[model samples]
Target: MNHTIPLALSIAGTDPTGGAGIQADLKTFQEREVYGMSVITSVVAQNTIGVQDVHHIPLDFIESQLKSVLSDLPPHSVKTGMIATPEMMEMIAAYLRNQSIPYVLDPVMVAKSGHALMDPASQDIVREALVPLATIVTPNIPEAEILVDFQIQDLYDAQRAAKVLVEELGAEAAVVKGGHLKGEAVDILYVNNRFYTFPSIRTNTKHTHGTGCTFSAVLAAELAKQKSIVEAVSIAKKFITDAIRYTLNIGNGNGPTNHWGYRLKNIPTVKGENHHV
Candidate 1:
């Protein structure tokens, strides 16, 4: 029997440590039962401890990679992470303009270990050129502040930031992740002028590396499977929660989340309903 599975693509940097960036995306996609493809944007020397250095791929080569994948096996959904420069963002935005697939933009700015992953100058370019093209833009507290030009202190502030991302920054939808905030891990999603709050119990662990990339990758995978944005976000939330709950205490520093946690015996479900996808 010949089976055709949905394909999800990640246009992002590479994390050799296998915890974040393209590596995380591919792992998440596979776990979500979608075929995964990748276009490397930058080569980063990074591990669970921190990012040591970065080597950006040339612009022409990046474009060629995009063309090579998109022209032939166009993905069902696409997500971007760790775009290191403004020029790369510009090119990606130009390419995404002509495609009609779900685009999840994870504005990866800094690493969990406080290392800068993207150029500070590219923040504005991402807000202007890339955010507008995203089907849903996911940003943590600091990233949200940079995109909306405001301070996000609490849940209310996060909600406001979500609105600003959709109404002002031109994103079709926005998810302001509250992982950086105190208490529960609450993520607010704003789309079609409606708000949805997904709150999960915070796991007190230091192994949550690549969570942003993993979440966005899962979202893209669900969308690739034709699930609604709301469903996709909800499922992705559960996925990350489980992954964090079963943290992998590997490296000496902040280790990585367990990517296979969803398949564990105790994975949570949404509203007592099993997530079939």
Candidate 2:
């Protein structure tokens, strides 16, 4: 039998812990039935507790890597995370400018261990160069604040931030994640002048490393499968919720979410039917 599988790519840094960055993205992509590819932008010596050091790949080498993959086997969708410098972001933007694919941007600024992953001065370049090139920009509360230059104190603030990301920052769509907010975890999406809100019950656990990367990766995978932005976001939300609910209790500090949790759980084969795993 001959068949074609959807391909998705992650252009990001490496997390040796296997809980975040390109590792998390590839895992999530495979879980969603999409073939995954990667272009390493930086290498980080990191663990669940914190990042100890980082080695950024040279700008020309980064471009060469992009060309190597893009020229030969272009992916159906692309997701980016942990691009540490403005120069790197600019080069990536140039490469992605002509490609017509679903581009999901995870503005990963800080790690779970309170380590900064991006340069402070690169925020503007990301907003101007990368954000506009993104088909969808996924930003958490703090990342949204940096992009929109406003404090996101509540749901209303998140909604405003999503709009600003779409209108002001030039992203075709925006997702303002509410994980940092108290109570239920909610995410607001703004696209085509419409707003959609997804809310899920919060899970009580410290094993929540790589959540942002997982969420955006799932979105990219779904997009690679030709799912609409709204549908992709909805499914990605559920995927992350289940992944968090069944988090892997490894490491002394925050651990990684279970990437295959959704598939392992008992799900209804038919609507209105109950099943157990």
Q: Best lDDT goes to which candidate? A: 1
Which lDDT values do the candidates have, in the order given?
0.88, 0.87
Error of 1 at 155 (Å): 0.6
| lDDT score at residue 176, model 2, on the 0-100 scale | 91
RMSD to the hidden true structure, all candidates: 3.7, 5.0
For the record, the alpha-carbon RMSD of candidate 2 to the native fold, in angstroms, is 5.0
Per residue, candidate 1 scores C-alpha lDDT tens digits across 25-61 of: 9999999999999999999998888878889999999
Model 1 residue 68 CA deviation (Å) reads 1.0
Please give, for residues 67-180, the per-residue lDDT of candidate 2 as tens digits. 888887889999999888888988899888988999999998765555555666898888889999999999999889888998999988998999888888899999999999
Screening candidate 1 with a backbone cut-off below 3 angstroms (N, C-alpha, C), the clashing residue pairs are none
C-alpha TM-score for every candidate: 0.94, 0.93
lDDT for model 1, please. Answer: 0.88
**Candidate 2 — which residues are off by over 4 angstroms?**
1-3, 113-116, 267-277
Best model per TM-score: 1
Worst lDDT 10-window in candidate 2: 268-277
